[model samples]
Target: MKLSALVPLVGVALLTVVLVGGCAATEPTPAAPGGTGDGHGHIEGATEMPEPQLRLVTLDSAGSLTAFDPATEASVSLTDVAGAELLTSDGRYAFAAADARLTIVDTGTWTVPHGDHSHYYLAEPRVVGMIDGGAGAGLGRAASNAALTAVFFPGSGETVVLDGEALGEGEIEELARIEGEPHEGAAVPLGEQVLVSSPDAVQVYSAAGDALGDEQRCEDMRGSGITSVGVVFGCADGALLTVEGEDGVEFERIPYPAGATPAESFANRPGRPDLAAPAGRSGAWLLDTREREWTLIRTEQPLLRAVAVGDSDGRVVAIDALGRIVVLTHEGVQATSEPLLAADLVGAELPAGVVLEVDASRAYVNSPSAGLVHEIDYVDNARLARSLDVEGDASALVEVAR
Candidate 1:
């Protein structure tokens, strides 16, 4: 046969072979680089991961932990820890009271400020560890710069200070455990020294349990706050301020005006220079830790909860008796949000309160009756940004950066 005729024969043979091979042989299709494909051609695990954002931690009535990301409006249910309360954060870790144990949770996100801007990162959020905090753990405070945390057990009258970094790493080591009269003492961790409340003074102790110096006179010390300048304890007559000096730690008693009503307690953001507390029925006390000055700001209505925001303008935010969120600056009421919670529940035993998170751009107010969390933009006229309806009775909320 001619070559042309042979070409037709070869083509027919090739087509016949391909048709037969297709029917006889079958093999699985390969998957994409990091994904497996279904029979219908849908690929799994091909989508991009979620970006890191600021998150809020809530302790529900059912004793479960919930992490909510405001940016994506997503929430995940974390493990449950019983009897958890007194939630506090150091921007990176959250310390909660779980009966006689202190439960530490990693927020898995953190921000680093650089000049006017900042950088944010994400990590794994988890329950890092726990510490035996004894009974009636009333206060949970963290000192970020000093890498320390103090938990006050009112029932035991013991203040337990722990290594912050170590606690976050799942290692429980007490820097100091000072015992005092039960239900009448408090403690603050100051670098190598721990300031503890005694019967008639604020006592200092080294991390190794040795007394540092003579106790500073602070009769009937009740409330304390940490600022950038130092740690302050409110007394019957004045405030005891502790600062780091060249030679050693320095203590000063900044007495209130001779006739001024004593400020029995105060509240301030961690590492800020300003502290705020209720002066009396209708007045608010502002303490400047850096200048050792006190300014009394009068409010038309009594405040149920007040927190110093530590802004440059000496602004403070307070919730009045009617569930109104009011922002006050030196010039007076900058803005006030409408009643977000039920006015009748103001003085009730409900787990309802406002938490002004440290160095946070927004404030979280929990309404247990409504099962909602109202997010307020503090920098912008105290605007009500949005509300998140969380599961369970949202008793406490804390914002933390990983």
Candidate 2:
């Protein structure tokens, strides 16, 4: 129930939370009342409702996005998603598309979009990847290695499967095109079918574009303000999971500790580019769709945006407004309190070369003000493991791999 009790579950120890329930018990200013910025509007009976899912999508104020290899910790990329308003991952690579071309950057390669015209770079997607629809609609997930792309373009109002590998080199072909709007569609390897969702419906399809005839429609969800297609485990209203069932789509909301605010409100920071926090306020609500009943995960940090790394067993990492990094594990939230190396782990004065690169990892901290990249090693509670210097304005750090 407290920070100390949460240590073992998080795989980290000794986290000191100064404030418990002791501060002025006064309600949070509606501006400051503790709640997620999902744009779900205040619910009258939400006070007694269960906590839903907690999914944090973080972004950097420095005009960059965070992409990580949740599997190996060996790779991470802080990319510029073509000045995208939001960044969401299919748990493997990061997606940023502009115009008709959807650029898929391998976190391992950290390839930059070149010349604004080039198509095939040295970088490659691992499975199936595709960019559907245009801006303000939704972007579908791409499986790096697969040759297919699960896409939904608003113009067509359908989810299309195209040969991703065959897309660039003048050999474009549509393998399967199913009927649906380009709300927000993410691919999940559910045996032989792909589950896709719009703001109003859920449709299941075969890998080869065959409609499985399984559909779940929600009549009451007309303008829930959720415009994006649903991922395997996407976000929903108030710490809940938006699931598709035989009957219809169900919102399995959870119940957590909710704090109310007074008429005089306070906000953490407005216009933050986080999926969990959105653009209006601070704080985030994370929901794990990978699980059946979406579990509500809460945090105090101002999450900007996030990238779900599939390589790391569906691990998700987020960056806060202050450029701090927080990772999601099977248990709970674990923050990088120290740097990367054992020597620079914790309790040591932050040495030169250790700059937290916006919101990637404490392992690589970049202080543009100082023009240095500190190699961080977070051990006990300290943030810097070891600081190392790098080139550039420290303006941005992208994973450039060979």
| Best-matching candidate per TM-score | 1
Every candidate's CA RMSD: 16.2, 21.3
Instruction: Let me know the TM-score candidate 2 reaches against the reference structure.
Output: 0.42
lDDT tens digits by residue: candidate 1, 235-323: 88888999878866789988887777777556665447899887766667888888898887777876666778887888887776667
Pick by lDDT: which candidate is best? 1
lDDT of 2 at 15: 16
Where model 1 places Cα greater than 4 Å from the true spot, the runs are 1-53, 111-121, 135-145, 343-354, 358-360
lDDT of 1: 0.67
lDDT of 2 by residue, 1-402 (tens): 111211111111221232335554654333323332222121111111111111112234343544333223232334555544323333224454444345454332221112342111222233223354444444333432223446544433556565433432223466676666544344432323455556555566666877676465532121111112222233222322344456544445433234411011001111111223221133333333334322224456544433333223333354444455555444545654432322332232232222222222333444445544444333223255544343233433332211
Residue pairs with clashing backbones, model 1 = 108-402, 109-401, 109-402, 110-402
* Per-candidate total of colliding backbone pairs: 4, 89
- Misplaced by over 4 Å in model 2 are 1-96, 104-147, 154-158, 163-173, 182-191, 218-231, 235-302, 306-317, 326-382, 385-402
Instruction: Give residue 135's error in model 1 in angstroms.
Output: 5.1
What are the Cα lDDT values of the candidates? 0.67, 0.36
